[model samples]
Target: PEHFLITLALPAETEVVWVEDFYRGIGDCLDMFGGFLAGGETSGVPSGSAAVISIAATGSVQREHLILRSTARAGDALFVTGTLGGSIHGKHLDFTPRVEAAGWLVRNFKPSAMMDLSDGLGKDLPRLAKASGCGFSIDETAIPVTTGSTVAEAIGDGEDFELLFCLEESRADGLLQAWPFADLPLTRIGRMEEDGKEQALGGGWEHFRS
Candidate 1:
């Protein structure tokens, strides 16, 4: 619920209709996100097997408001919202998404590319660069490392759930100055380099490795 909220910036009052197997505190979790359990299914699994739950959601937005990662271009400045790393220490489950910040950005400046940092900056940044047909040069020192998190962890610790985006370099300062989320920390991390030769970073969660 929280992840989708930040991803889409849907209204808090919006309800999430879903279906799922029975689980303790399920209703409570939905309530926390201002969602109501519209309908669901319940069943018992084999005694020793783990139960699985699946949820589906829907939201609406005007066509003009859509943003995509492929729009990034050379000379665009990269920025990240909120701290990174050590998400395993409660940040992943508790941190709020940058929905409001993203809205403000779209309203004030046109971002060339945008995405959430779920699979770690190291892994995700390359994907964004590829989609945009550009390379990226990031300043390690400018990355916002969370307390108790090393720079490496900030690069690789998956589930940070912050926003990473690129915008025109000329508008970077004005956007930063007009940013409305006083509580959310925003940092300029890098720029889009030339296409075809990407400077990639190491570390990130891999679902499968030998």
Candidate 2:
């Protein structure tokens, strides 16, 4: 009983061979996480229009096991997998998603909240906290920075493709010992709080601000 997935992509105005290559890449990426490429609609733009590719995906998970950012309870321990930051140095395009690791945790820890760190921790963590009606404090010093990456970069550079989750504090020690991936580090960075000052949180995304 796998949580089957269907993904689709449509690339426009490309040769048949190139389209095949794109589909192959998309299939491979989805296959890495027990998913299949289904299909996508195509819309070709006029000449001199910017190149565009559209993709969509759907997945199914049991209602009881579904993890969400808006459900972390105060005092739950926060964690993130793998080192963060410096993805722009090349890791972003080549990073591995923590799909397997997430499944493992679901089968074991039953986290209170979870989400992928697509945006930087600085941006995403606050979102999770806000949605949960709680506040958070992360130790910037404990952020697992990639080699040659600064703590600031780890806080804001993003593209880590890691698992950010919360678990009951009582089970935290067991998690530390029972984690199976020695190659991938699981870091306990912070925790949720009931009465924390939310004013310190900032998104740090520079591109678009309103």
Q: Pick the candidate with the highest TM-score.
A: 2
Reference-based TM-score, model 2: 0.85
Q: Cα deviation in Å at residue 94, candidate 1? A: 0.9
- Which segments of model 1 are wrong by more than 4 Å? 1-40
Worst 10 residues of 2 by lDDT: 1-10
- Candidate 2 CA-lDDT value: 0.79
The residue-by-residue lDDT of candidate 1 on 115-155, one tens digit each, is 99989999999989999889999999999999999999999
Q: Write the per-residue lDDT of candidate 2 for residues 64-158, one digit (tens) a residue.
A: 77889899998889999999888769888877778789989998988999999878888888888888998887887787999998888888887
Scored against the true structure, residue 138 in model 1 reaches a CA lDDT of 91
Clashing pairs in 2: none
Each prediction's TM-score versus the true structure:
0.80, 0.85
